[model samples]
Target: MISARNFLHFSRGVALAAAVCFFAATLAVAQTDALPSWNDTAPKQAIISFVEKVTKPDSADFVPEAERIAVFDNDGTLWVEHPIYTQLAFALDRVKSLAPQHPEWKETQPFKAVLEGDMKALAASGEKGLVELIMTTHAGMTTSDFQKIVIDWLASARDPKFKRPYTELVYQPMIELLAYLRANGFKTFIVSGGGVELMRPWAEKVYGIPPEQVVGSSIKTEFRMEDDTPTLFRLPEVNFIDDKAGKPVGINQQIGRRPIAAFGNSDGDLQMLQWTTMAGGPARLGVLIHHTDAAREYAYDRDTEFGRLDKALDAAAITGWTVVDMKADWKQVFKD
Candidate 1:
């Protein structure tokens, strides 16, 4: 007969194995708690419940992979948008770099202000100044040339306030949520007010959203040939402004069908969430990422010079969109 001591040793081995299994299971659950990071509000529950119902093969609410459309705004929603928009800074930097070539820019109203580092004067010019800055530096070149310039600049560009790569400054929670949704068969797209071409050049590398999946503000362009060389040059004109009401129009123009899910963080995205949720769907979801932590990320609304969030807040309540308080919802904002 086996000794009682040997039997006890076998029992101890089995107990240790069971303990390891239990610990492993707990770790797995913790890692998969992406939705748990969200608040317990009705809007948050709606998203979690919908995702569960759709992913279950036996459920009547199961949505096919092709029908899962998720759209996200880029600025305040996906990354930081305080003090100023990153693209505007990009345009200003471009003005400074290209100013030497175009000496007339020294006399130009907005470009001259940007060159002289007179932000107060630039803002006083208001919308007219903002538009002039975008047009002068963003346009007037081949799309390929513009793309190359953005790529090269981004390599060295760091957020002036945070001192991190503008790309690295993206919200960590959103990045995790994006990957989780994609793993469950959701196709993600970025619908931002920023220039489409500007986003397309680096979005695939940064966010994993291919150029074809991006929809944003765009300028008009024409295909042409210059002495046996084919080229596509940007026009000094506006094609569409993908903000507020324009967001829905741009989505319809590009994505065709209404998205079942949408995310935004400002008045610029109010119409986008409205369109996403009001499209006669039983399982549509909308989320808004609110910047509330002034210490971690700058916070301002309505009267703020950039990324005014007041109108969007009103719409959030009316439309039942999930407004994620940055201070409460996310444990960390950036990788840094």
Candidate 2:
């Protein structure tokens, strides 16, 4: 028989041990659940099943280390793209910010629309206006300097609809998927049509992908000295446009290897999926994120001003691309 103090100490130790075990078990369960935030759907299930099959050793569908490449489009696929392109919105806002210094912009078409908050005129300018806006606001600065501007803007910029930072506007389900693939030895890359320089500033923090892993549309840049400090300055010339068929070209040029998995939302990403499938690799998967949740997010197809999804819709069934309906599949959208 032990003394009363010894008995009490032993009981306390036992309780602590039980508590630790319980906590650990709870944590393990939570972590397991974290990756499957999306509701049961063929696309979500397929994603999980593919990752498990490829990553598990001794599995018939096990993908080798060199071949475990997964690529994702950035804009509409990974985050929200509505009420006009968010990056374009950022560029317009930057144009407004600089209008005070560049008084000539007050009289210019796109710049005038930006300064006066004239959406009608802005839309009327169309792609040419958009190109001019991007060229004027995003270029003529060192890469590092532009990156800092992007970082600053994203930190302060809030989505007009959600009232959240642009960074926080990312899809919760996709983020989990990114983490899940990375955990299973898949090298996740952001093969976006958005500007490479724009995405580089925050992709690592937001998507867990480094700048090198992000391949996208690029503008010309030249090395120059400002105040005797040598830096790379962005030139107002398009080097590449990583959209539609350009997606595959950019991927091939940059990665030099076909990705085993491709995820995208719009027709801009259709060529990427095509390339992934047509390349003829083992156990390839192509997924398209269909925006169907109107309340949680704006939903439009074919007629939408930004990220039109018409062609991709028709191709989904014929090509076997899994179209994920956001309203049905996602248990949650933006992170709380």
Candidate 3:
């Protein structure tokens, strides 16, 4: 009963609606692809399978939301840690800023080495000298003042190689993984060798991790009354080094429960991974982000100074840990 012209118009409207619906469905699928930066490789498949198994309510490997703890190493695991650690870079820069105050530092061995950019001399200065550098720059300030200093430094400091803010150097794929895990009812925590205060300032904004959820090395702090105000002053004293064996200790002290999944990049994280995945009651997930993409990011393992991956690399194979080859496994490195 319709006219020919009216029928043609109706057909056109139906075609347009179908096109819109198809486009929308395509977009939805694209948006839901959790780790778009990760290639469809063994590592990616392993991650998806593990997540599915644990998240599925009917599956035997299912973990309840309360017990879904995931711990991550900060430096080379989540962000770039090459040439030197971000915290160490901050300390070196601080030495230059404070050199004016201490005129004797110009002739001092370790301080002089840092000032002259003499890597050999700095290395010769040994652990004692390194401790001296950290103490001089990191101490003598209140907690609040130190936090402000760190915040200010992070805002201005740029990674020498990338020429971008250090925070921006964080891996896009890892960020996606973190989000994916959290979406699947996992509580993510940052367990790093970096100073707790150094990471707490920006971790929430950058990694979606809260300050209290961060566990790391700490310097001694003293409570004092400053001008009728209570303040906690940072001291030049070592509290704990959350690396290697200390990682497990830090995890226990901070998280109070054993994590079912752990992620790391270097030998320093081996103990944490072992504690998490090898404890072995049920299915567990351990992932190591192997930096193999020299073109996109730095490629160094087994002999790297910053993130030495010798022992852990060996352990991964024997323990069935997922070693993510950045070159082959990741579609991208940093986020745009």
Q: Give, for candidate 3, the lowest lDDT window spanning 10 residues.
A: 27-36
* Model 1, span 1-336: residue lDDT tens: 768999899899899999999999899977867754455565456667878887788877777889888999999888877668889989989988888899998887887788889988888878988888888888899999999999998889889899887888888878877877897899999999999988898888888899999999988999999999899999889999998999999999999988888989888888999998887646678888878889888767677766788888987788777778888766677876
**Of candidates 3 and 2, the better by TM-score:** 3
Candidate 3 per-residue lDDT, tens place, 153-226, comes to: 99999999999999999999999999999989999999999899999999999999999989999999999997
Clashes of 3: 0
Q: List where candidate 2 sits over 4 angstroms from the true fold.
A: 1-31, 225-228
Model 1 lDDT-worst window of ten: 35-44
By TM-score, how accurate is candidate 1? Answer: 0.87
Q: Which candidate is the best by lDDT?
A: 3
TM-score of 3: 0.91
